[model samples]
Target: MHPALSIIVFTTLSGLGYGLATALGTGLLDPAATATKAAHLLALALIAAGLMSSTLHLGNPQRAWRAFSQWRSSWLSREGVMAVLTFLPLAASAFLAIFESRYEPALGLAGAALSLVTVYCTAMIYASLKSVQTWHTPLTPLCYLLFALAGGFSLSTFFAAMGGGNLLLSSGLAAFFVCLAWIAKLVWRNRMNTLRPISTPETATGLGFIGKVRLFERPHINDNYLTNEMGFRVARKHAVKLAALSFGLGGIVPVALLLGLLALGAAHPAVAVGVALLAVLSHITGMLVERWLFFAEARHAVMNYYGG
Candidate 1:
């Protein structure tokens, strides 16, 4: 359950990159349109960078070629397949956009749709794991997709504000997504808080004892891989604090800044870009901690042996 930075960066980066690509493919990018080309390009770059980081997390990077072999049964395989396939439409559409082809918008739409599927596949990689009861829910994938888009769109807003002094669209998008992500997060957290493990010490031991069974007559003196891996625990009060910080820094602050800039008609490049970066950084940081707590907070089936 130890949080790995490589995994964290991989997830966070891919989430942001592909998420932004999702919106861009949906006509968010128009050379002759409202948004800027620079924003679109920046998003594409980030997406590529994120995917690269994610790929680096594999144990045998060379054997990563085999990842796409079992899409029928594996979410990770599906994610790998979908993530790679997303690039075809993205490249074609981006090419048309840059070349000013009449068919660019259509291509962009196709890519956007595929990008969304890619994100869903990535989310499902975690949600489909039935062993992790805390993550075994429809909301898990839904939350992942929503947060990625929220993060992507927020990054786009910053890029757009820098290129064109328009705060209205990004602000509106940020505010709306903040509310949606918050609600989804709260729903997941509350559901997790109420759920109890289905296993017990007796079940693990097959003693069939009917009376009160405790995990320890004597305390555990040695820490092993199981305890180190699955014994991670989080304090409720600290979790609340982290959630509050995430809501404020990741959710509230960026929207407030955008709104403020809009009100004053002062969407300077620096301010807009700064806010956008801040939003991306804060949101990703919060999600990182959230993901950490997510793994740490879950009580594993093996814990029944320890009377957890």
Candidate 2:
């Protein structure tokens, strides 16, 4: 709930990487193009870098190696494993695209699938945590998937615009998908706002006498790890303002620019590349705020004891 910068970087960077891989698989990147492959590989490198940096947030870097051992029950482990495995096919495809021609498409397709799986695993890491009612929903996974797609589409628009020619088509597609994702995001936000907390103080404390329990004493004078991690609370009005800013800057502005690019028949490289850069930057930043509020706004049963 405190919103680790490492995590923010990790998610946004990984989103970009995964999105690129998806575009490659979907033929949006045109793997036959040498420039496209080069750009994609570069993006993948950025993703790997972000993920590695995120690992530092863990208490024990050495013990992080043990994470891969529990893929059976842990979404985090699955995410790590899948994240690493995805690189193999992606690198291989990039290599083949550069050196050999025959097997590139097949390898690219495999990389794309692996990338999607990695993203899904990451999504489940949050969605599966039942203690967090706001995150534990079917919509969570869908949101992650859509975000990945939207982000990927945004990247493809830039890459294509830069290397090939006009980005009008890709920008149009990005705008369309972004709008759709925004709608879904709104639905999710509304659902979360209206949803009741999964537990109450009495249930957690096992004290059956409950008409309403208000905080009678301080849990601690100073914040402990749990309080720091889970006790984050934001004003409703402030959250609404932030959400509006995120939606407008991240969603609406980019789409409007893209549509304008199309209408004006703007220069190929500038229009496409500009939109892509702005969209990814805005969206990723917005996602950071969103993820932060997501954890912060959640009402834990313990909070009721704190008179939340």
Candidate 3:
């Protein structure tokens, strides 16, 4: 499918936002600390920005509100509903953290669980689409959830380092999550590399019993909406290069920095904070590239009719 900039930004930013919010909900940071207050504001900003960006891909942003009506059957609608519901407890918890300087176990835990459910719903938006073989798998949601945790904990490590909290522990969690996310991503990519098209030209036309089906004439003289939106293609070489870059930036560097933070034992607060910041930046950039590839590399079964 065509890689839409709005969706990419939406997923990447929201994933990070939800992840960070999850960390806060779990009471991972000291509620009374100034850094915790800042983190709360940051999480809200990221989520709001991402949710807003998501509307850009819609043909009519004004009608986007209609998406909420299909929650019974639509993953997209479920995501919208969950996103709004998740924001409530999260915002309330943030309010308490910022003003009252306290963490309520019930609110925090509720927000954390809801935050994860929202992310799962978002991933299911793509994973549920049977037309796209690349995205139709259990691994899709697994990668999405793992990446959210990895990025969330990495950002948490930065705040923990800034506040002089348990920097070592936060960094250790960050490193562990980063490792887990990358491993899952590697497995996902391998599946993409090996899986054959479930729907080919022959199967699509139901002519496999007779002979191979080939496009003798163009479907249209000019490109149509389906061709433009669902027929995007990417070269294998560029994909390999981008995949390497994503793994390195989004996974390896963050893990290394976080592991180093663990080894330092909170001896150098300033250095730890700086390193944590770099890891967050690198991880975000890497995930952006990964999200791009996630869309670019996907092959929609509808393309078989278009001679894709």
Clashing residue pairs in candidate 3, if any?
A: none
Winner on TM-score (2 vs 3): 3
Give the alpha carbon lDDT tens digit for every residue of 241-293 in model 2.
87887787768876776676567564555655676677767777776676666
Tens digit per residue, CA lDDT, model 3, 6-100: 99999999999999999899898999999999999999999999999999888788988899899999999999999999999999999999999
Better of 1 and 3 by TM-score: 3
- Tell me the tens digit of each residue's lDDT in model 1 across 53-111: 77775778888889889999999899888877888887776665556632366777777
Can you tell me which runs of candidate 2 are displaced by over 4 Å?
32-35, 98-103, 208-210, 234-237, 264-268
Best of the candidates, lDDT: 3
Clashes of 2: 0
Quantify all predictions' global Cα lDDT against the true fold: 0.69, 0.73, 0.92
TM-score for predicted model 1 compared with the true structure: 0.85
Candidate 3 Cα outliers beyond 4 Å, as residue runs: 235-237
> Model 3, poorest ten-residue lDDT window?
228-237
Candidate 3 Cα lDDT to native: 0.92
**Higher lDDT: candidate 1 or 2?**
2
Q: 1 or 3: which has the higher lDDT?
A: 3
Lowest summed lDDT window (length 10), candidate 1: 28-37
